[model samples]
Target: MPIPACPVVHFELPYRDAARVSTFYQTVFGWQLQPMGPEMGNYILATTSTCDSSAPDALRGSINGGLFPLVPESPLQQPSVVLGVPDVREAMARVSAAGGQVLGEPMAIPGVGDYVVFVDPEGNRLSMLQPLMG
Candidate 1:
């Protein structure tokens, strides 16, 4: 059997000014911005399309994302896409085997899933997420 396909389920971008970026996207694209608390790194969740709470990925072709405060020292400060994987650990191994570098250990996102960043062979920054099952 062929390997399971991982889909781009989310996108993330860093922002210098939270209010400015939130207003821009909300006013221009009509995206609903939900500001998370400090416990969750103050990440701003952006809902670009309608979704079913019972099923996170139930709405095919529709993806949501988050906006994070930009940290100049971090390597993953640029815009990037997040691929949904069934197993983040396995994906990390695959990335390394394919000559890509896993940036760090997987981090748990409360109410979300395990997530880890990686760099592809061509140096593009990306992430893998193993979402929590209900």
Candidate 2:
């Protein structure tokens, strides 16, 4: 049996200036940006494509993302992709066994799921997410 596929479901970018970054993407690419409240770390949700909730696979091949404030001490303050997995812990173990470094423990995103950041062997930052089931 082949291993299950983990698809890139989202992208993230760090922004020094929220207003500038939000305006750039919105004006240039027509992305819809929704700024979250402080409870959500002031993250800006970027919707690059439309999807119908009532339809299955409505977001196939498309993804939405978030813009987070850049933290000087954070190594993950760079553009990265988020891969969806069935189990975040299992995926973290696999990443470590494959010579990647799991940065820290998984953090829960409200209404989303468990998420963790990691770095590949080549030092590329990425994340894995076990989405919450309805």
Candidate 3:
């Protein structure tokens, strides 16, 4: 059978030290890392494959993610996959019904759309994102 199209859109990981974690991945995997300023919460954009960062839509079967500062109080302080959903609110409800726990309420990213985190029944962390429509 063919693979389903609900591919993982992005991934994320937390780090106690952004520079150190960025360097580790860059050195080990040769992935490109772009550090965002304080306004973006010191997030590091990780480019895992050879896709062009300037035009992400050109890539196929590939994804990249960000490295965020670890927050002691946050449940999102673990590596997680961000699945693209058509509606984050609906996804949250579905997660709850499917024996998963939604971490918190969905929040709208400045230019992005709604995003929420969750933990599967087996306790693996994951996230859902509803991209901003054009």
Candidate 4:
């Protein structure tokens, strides 16, 4: 079979209270929430699966995710998925040609990569990320 063009590298959830949301995910799902400070936007990394000493090498389809504050005025305030792409600009163009509207210009996320969000024809919001290469 041919290779996949892109895969979902991560997922995210929105919250008002970082502590409460982190604690809730940890308590109910046994997930580990790693705190990130203001420079990273006070986000929380939710380790839902892993390939570490404690957990077995994760299978092909599983992924870890993060939680961030809900920006009340943002076009994508709801829970959204982040899709990995080779080029953010190209992806944005393809999304438009495919009937989706790119919400805004691509923004560079420190330590992450080029990122932009969009809304599909059905009104579902999602994001695309061109991860930084080490």
lDDT of 2 by residue, 11-130 (tens): 999999999999999999989999997899989999988763547646556889999999999676889999999999999999999999999999999899999999999999999999
lDDT of 3 by residue, 6-117 (tens): 4578899888987789889999988889998798889888888755545655555779899889999966478999999887787787789999999879888789788888
Residues 51-103, candidate 1: write the lDDT tens digits: 64557655557889999999999776899999999999989989999999999
User: Candidate 3's C-alpha lDDT?
Assistant: 0.84
Angstrom error of the Cα, residue 66, model 1: value is 0.6
Residue clash pairs of candidate 1: none
Comparing candidate 1 with candidate 4, which one achieves the higher lDDT? 1
Each prediction's TM-score versus the true structure? 0.91, 0.92, 0.83, 0.86
**Which one wins by lDDT: 1 or 2?**
2
RMSD (CA, Å), candidate 2 to true, equals 2.4
**Which segments of candidate 1 are over 4 A away from where they belong?**
51-60
Model 4: per-residue lDDT, tens digit, 1-134?
A: 44348888888889999889988998998888998889889889888876434546665467788988898997668888899998889889889999999988999988989988889999988889999999
For residue 98, model 1's alpha carbon misses the true position, in angstroms, by 0.3
Better of 2 and 3 by TM-score: 2
Candidate 1 TM-score over all chains jointly? 0.91
Candidate 4: residue 68 Cα off by (Å): 1.4
Of 1 and 3, the candidate ranking higher by TM-score? 1
Off by over 4 Å in 4: 1-4, 51-60
User: How far out, in Å, is residue 38 in model 4?
Assistant: 1.5
Q: Which predicted model would earn the best lDDT?
A: 2
